[model samples]
Target: MDGGERYQEFDPPKALRPWVRKVWTYACPSPSRTIQRIAPDGCPELILDLGDPYEEADADGVFHLQPPALFAGQMTRPIAIRPVGPVELVALRFHPDGARDWLGRSLRTATDQRLNMTDRLRDLSPPAGDPEAQARQMIDWMAGQRRDDWSIDPLVRTEVEAIHADQPSPPRDASARRALQRRFLDRVGIAPRTLRSVIRFRRVFDHAMAEEAEGWLSAGLDAGYFDQPQLAREFRRFLGCTATEWAREQVELARAIASQSYKPGGPEPG
Candidate 1:
């Protein structure tokens, strides 16, 4: 399966650009479909995961679970098989500057999900006991995510502005960028751009698909592809398929996720 889930877009505060990475929530078919990703460092991740699946792999196969984060030195290009069951996950991709010390361990690795300063994620969660409540709770949770606290005070807010626009993928302020980036790399511990690129790239398709276009060429170009071949190259690079094959799956997955039973406010009816 490829591109089967309903992925939501999110932007991080610009001021936190050096420290904060990308953040988002995704809903997909359960028992997630497999995705083969080609990372920047020549590392190929054959990922088959559920919500917030983290890194672990071998020849026998792969295993995924939430927390117990890992160190991803740089951002990687992603390609995924379609998901098979319903899934909801909140994700934060680390920027190079946002690098943290304990990213290589599980959520319980350093101090547990709470004090894990590797990514130094903050949570101002309100109480929620059930599914529906959780959804509503996350809506608000995401709201606070907008405030990137410069310091990790638990309920802290950073002064960074969110940069969700596709244009500045390459930053203009090299010096200042490097300074804030130093804060992430030297202190916190992992790559925030790694988090930004993957999450941003994923959302690119999520938004592209909603337009109900005919092919991947058009979609990629709209996102500023140099040419159809360029788009195809990236498609194959990330997804292990040509543009046509990937487009075919995108269409199928969209339909699968949008069957008549799909409802936004209610449970994904089976």
Candidate 2:
């Protein structure tokens, strides 16, 4: 990471709030070429690489260069990325149930995959400028892409809200649970239980980063884990590492970016 590196998130415009979570930018005038591990958070992303393209390692540890524009679908595991040069990119993070509308496809088709969107990039090309200006351009393009009849499944939205709020999910019989799972696969790209687990892991990660608790055990407990072993299992499941190991490996830029706070569907700060 360079001293010039920065990561900032901006809220989506009011009309697009239901579909888009946030528009964000990451830039580094001179990157240090460190591999950063990005853990899953249950949201799909549209990433436009405005600067040098990044190298993403596959499951077999083979590094493949990414396209200038791509759609990253719901990831069940962590991915490692290394900057090939100076880095700058604008990203649109869609809510779990929101992407299927903009993408015009089943979310399940894109799960754990980064699909090339270079052809679609022509319409989204940003003029040379600062990241904020580029981000505005991207957001404006997304606004144009919005359809009048676009809408998310009401049941999916309700379940997503429950997960984020850390509230007990509504009681469901086996048949209801199966029905919800089908809807979630089509709209959210993951099972309902998987989403819940990911959100819970996010709380633990945030707590650890904030140092709000004495240790990982306390943080996990605060995040609703039954015991240390359960927390450790989640850590390995989401991050592919223990809690302490993940913290130890976080680069300065990753740490700083992860520490920022924002509530979903809230008003964007000026």
Per-model CA lDDT versus the true structure = 0.36, 0.80
Best by lDDT: 2
User: How much is 94 displaced in model 1, in angstroms?
Assistant: 10
Q: What lDDT is reached at residue 119 by model 2?
A: 93
Model 1 worst lDDT window (10 residues): 261-270
lDDT of 2 by residue, 1-270 (tens): 357878878878888888888888887878777777778887899989888889999989989999999999998888888888877888898887889988898999999999999898777877544778888998999998988889968898989888888888899999999999999999999998888888878776765553323565786787789998888788788778776666767773456555662222321222
Query: How far off is residue 246 in model 1, in Å?
Result: 3.8
* TM-score (C-alpha) between model 1 and the true structure: 0.41
Model 1 segments more than 4 A misplaced: 1-75, 79-130, 136-163, 167-174, 184-214, 247-270
Please tell me which predicted candidate would have the highest TM-score against the true structure: 2
